[model samples]
Target: MRLTPFRAFDWNLRSCGLHGHVTYRPDEEPLAERLHTSTPVGEAWRCLRCGTFALGAPAAAGPADEAPLVLRGRALRDAVILRLLAAERGIRGLLLLLLAYGIYRFDGSRQALRKTLDDYLPLLKPAAMKAGVDLEHAGPVRLIEHALTLKHSTLLLVSAGVLAYGILQLTEAVGLWLMKRWGEYVAVVGTSIFVPLEVYELVEGFTWLKVGALVVNLAAVVYLVWSKRLFGIRGGHAAFEAERHAESLLAVEHAAALA
Candidate 1:
């Protein structure tokens, strides 16, 4: 929409007594001129003097064909988080979709699936025996056997569940990438649902990976609730809007002038 510049990094101009003013190096003048003129309307660029990053320029214009404007933040942290989460969700969705396809294929040709597993068994047996594992009673072996014995209806149910999960993950991925508020709410709820299970797993057995997962989930929940002000934290939705407004270039310019 607006495509205005955003200050992505803090600069202590007060220390240099320059306020918001900056002086670029002689060598940087040519590059600055190019950046000033040729930077795409919605592209990000850095301040020539302080090297701080900003998205769009003061006079940047949005194409009539562009989508509605996103209220990007002055700080880059939240943008980074949103992008990372989008990537994570997209990967998870893809994996789930692959797993669902595999399950469907296995159910469609049980004989072929069994034959494939049998063929691989010889190669796997030696390794298992060397590791002192009994293949007959191993969890993986039993799970495979159970899968083979599943009725068509059960297989269908399993495939449906996996497909649904994949769809949910993909939906969240796209929404978060767009920085939608609904996406944040969905992510917060989805992650919160697993917190108890993750905690129980940690209580059952302690491992660095488990602890790390728990910590990461908890951190995401806290960050969304506190930083994004979900469900009325701080001054609630009004405060959220006000904060975004305050981060705009005009607001920054006004503050600099007053300072």
Candidate 2:
């Protein structure tokens, strides 16, 4: 029987499994040792008898548990979006803090403020009447009056709550920007806590602003839950990792070749 000469194949072995160089020449070390040093290149080896390619050993664990390039890009995009939203929350918190400060300042001049409002009522009443609104009977007007007349203890409590909430927003922003898992949980819970309030506001009075806020919050919640695989939704982290691995270039190529 005659042996057919073997030639180097045109395809790359790196995709199959070979990480580095492979030498075919005779060397001082044994052949088995040399072959052992070369990582297995699946289905890329050639036989000396017929020059046909032969399948090698199964692939080892990959370099790292990395997702597909596209999936990584998508994660980056989502992170950017979440960070931007987090920044918006931070700004909102700051604004709320400023409002709280103003309220605290007003608490000291409640009588004077009430007098001023009462004096302006004559002017406001006419415009409100023209607009078919009753300023005297409006819920917001009553609430503002109540807030202005709050005792010192009540005012301090309200201001403290606002400051604490603003700090929470800033905390969430930092966590999300860093892509910490805990941040996602905090964001979900914090945002969800206000959903009912937002819904109530919409029910009481519809406005484009309220609708938009509700929609955005709902979108963020859904995106984080589904895409990030939070709370064991869609097989949780393990399944998410598996899905990412399946999308890798090598895996895709292997499946196509098999097909």
Best by lDDT: 1
Residues 1-259 of candidate 2 have per-residue lDDT tens digits of 7665534432234222333322121122332222222335543422211222445642232222231223223444575688887887778778877877887787788889889878898889989999999998898888878887678999988988887777777777777777777788888888898899999999999999999999999998898888878899999889876766655543323322332
lDDT of 1 by residue, 1-259 (tens): 7664544344343322343322221123344343333334565434432334445543332321121222323334576788898898899899999999988888889998789888997788889999999887887888998899999999989999999889888888887888888888888887787689889999998999999878877887898888889999898789987766544433223222332
| RMSD over all Cα atoms, model 1 | 10.6
Cα lDDT of all candidates, in order?
Answer: 0.67, 0.64
Each candidate's root-mean-square deviation in Å?
10.6, 14.1
Worst 10 residues of 1 by lDDT: 61-70
TM-score of each: 0.66, 0.60
Off by over 4 Å in 2: 1-72, 123-142, 239-259
Q: List the residue pairs that clash in candidate 1.
A: 1-69
lDDT measured at residue 154 in model 2 versus the true structure, 0 to 100: 90
